[model samples]
Target: MTEESDSPMTDTDSTTTGPLVPEDITADSPFTLPGFFAALAEGRLVAARCTECDTHLLPPRPACYGCGSRAVTLSEQPRTGEVISYTSVNRPPSAFDHLAPITVAVVELDSSARLTGRVDASLEDVTIGDRVELQVRDPETVDIDPDFGLSYEEEWPIHVFELI
Candidate 1:
């Protein structure tokens, strides 16, 4: 009778290999929604522009919303923008309780793309039309994810903005 080993098996199922390691996860496309944001690690604020309608997509999409065109191009935008609107979170959510009194603002990028991000300013300092500059932040420091359905982690970059 042979004593069986409980160790992990290789592709050939020899069982001589130790525990199997997880496969490396990666994005499908460099211009995918997550991929665009991931570039922030390099201090870049990139967006997808529709080739047909010439509309820029902030979160990025495969198809253009204006004309339903499948042709999209990802590009970096001017790093400055004006604050369109904003709100403050005094009673923060579970993931942001440590960062209460956080001010979130919608900024219209110089290229006409609207992106929401946290501003480093007091309540009195923030106002509509105020010029703000993009500042890449360690995602954990910002502790907020503008991308709905995707959680922000320390490894990702947070495209934060500050009044200029």
Candidate 2:
């Protein structure tokens, strides 16, 4: 087989732009969640873009799910997006009871990458097509219970959205 092929299984082109081996996927690489969150904490949103298919992978991985290609590269994502769908969670898990009636939305960013996150608005205030901007918060700033599966040392960044 050559470098290019129409069949997904036969597409063996190695556009491998980023890490190509396990030893290269360090915490400093955006290909991992730790690295992804690290960038978020620094006020930057990053994703993996497949060179072969233009698929954007949030919380980036090494391979492209779209064309089964391993030629993914780090990409900075946009903070603004529109609300594609939303809902209110009146009954949340016990650990998140303090945040009852949480409003969540699946936002499609300007790059067409979609991610689900809490919206800093009441259910009644949010609607389809509403413009919003991403907000990254230190986990401690939020009222999540300590036992919410995250340890103090591993304080993860919380992603949310606010109407623009």
Candidate 3:
């Protein structure tokens, strides 16, 4: 009788091969926040795509929220998207007060994944359906106060949207 592959149970299948095992969820794996930020810092945007229901999970989780399936795989996301909604934060939190009147928006990426981010334009310059591209910047390069980041988030990259 064939021993069904003879691999250890602790092994996690490749991202596109099968369900995500507990062994696959690690700080160095894209399924976790640290891993997600690490990939973002490297100029790669990654998300979790559920094989069972085709749901995309940003800041990727191990399980598929759409179908409660663990058969999720890593998917690279497109930088271009359309603005779905927007608003201006006239009174942002104290940590972001220095950049008040910030224009933010919900963008639906070309991959159908959506995420909210700060827009480079002013509130008056933005409108629904505007084309935008994601921009990545080092945390220190952004204008926000240095203290705004938590100790653990000091190295995470910040993302913004630029009108296209």
Candidate 4:
């Protein structure tokens, strides 16, 4: 991986070649929720925060389960966390029909909130309580986009370590 300088550029005379934005991932039914897609569009991981307890909840719900607060705020989450549990899916459901046996892990964020995502690393290297990061790989660069309606580009990979 190469590091690029984070310099602000003027709109009129900028000469930096930034990363290419990849196509958004889409899904049918519940996965197509507006809030869910909005987070990814802005390159942020959004979760619901409880107004009463100030607790962050992943896979955000309309109301906080902890305090039953309807006044919830959708906020970005840190990219680092520790693996609480995980499992490899040799036979995924129909929705994940296109992905080869992928490993999924339940990660506990620094805030103690847990969210599940694909583990990009090898299965042998993954373990409970291991440090893991969130990686957003572009499907286009990899030339492998599943036909399940989700699209991604390969050249612009966004990987963030939430825990280590």
The TM-score obtained by model 3 is 0.87
Considering summed lDDT, which 10 consecutive residues are worst modelled in model 1? 8-17
TM-score of each: 0.73, 0.87, 0.87, 0.62
Candidate 3: deviation at residue 109, Å? Answer: 0.2
lDDT of 1 by residue, 97-153 (tens): 666788899998777778898888877899998888889877555655444225534
The sequence of per-residue lDDT tens digits that candidate 4 reaches over residues 29-133 is 112245454455456565666656766666555567787766655555666677888778887766555665767888876655677777876577788878766
| lDDT by candidate, in order shown | 0.65, 0.80, 0.81, 0.54
> Per-residue lDDT for 73 in model 3?
78
lDDT at residue 142 of model 3 (Cα atoms): 84
The parts of candidate 2 lying over 4 Å away from their true place are: 1-16
Clashes of each: 0, 0, 0, 14
Which residue runs of candidate 1 sit more than 4 Å off their true CA positions?
1-28, 143-154
Estimate candidate 1's alpha-carbon lDDT, on a 0 to 1 scale.
0.65
* Candidate 3: stretches off by over 4 Å: 1-14, 17-20
Alpha carbon deviation, residue 4, candidate 4 (Å):
25
TM-score of 4: 0.62
Compute the lDDT of residue 13 as modeled in candidate 4: 11
The sequence of per-residue lDDT tens digits that candidate 3 reaches over residues 1-164 is 11222221121225553334667567888788898899999988888877788888897787878888877778878788889999999999887887888999999887777899999999999999888888999999887888888888999999999998
Q: All predictions: root-mean-square deviation over Cα?
A: 17.6, 8.3, 9.7, 11.2
Model 3 lDDT-worst window of ten: 1-10
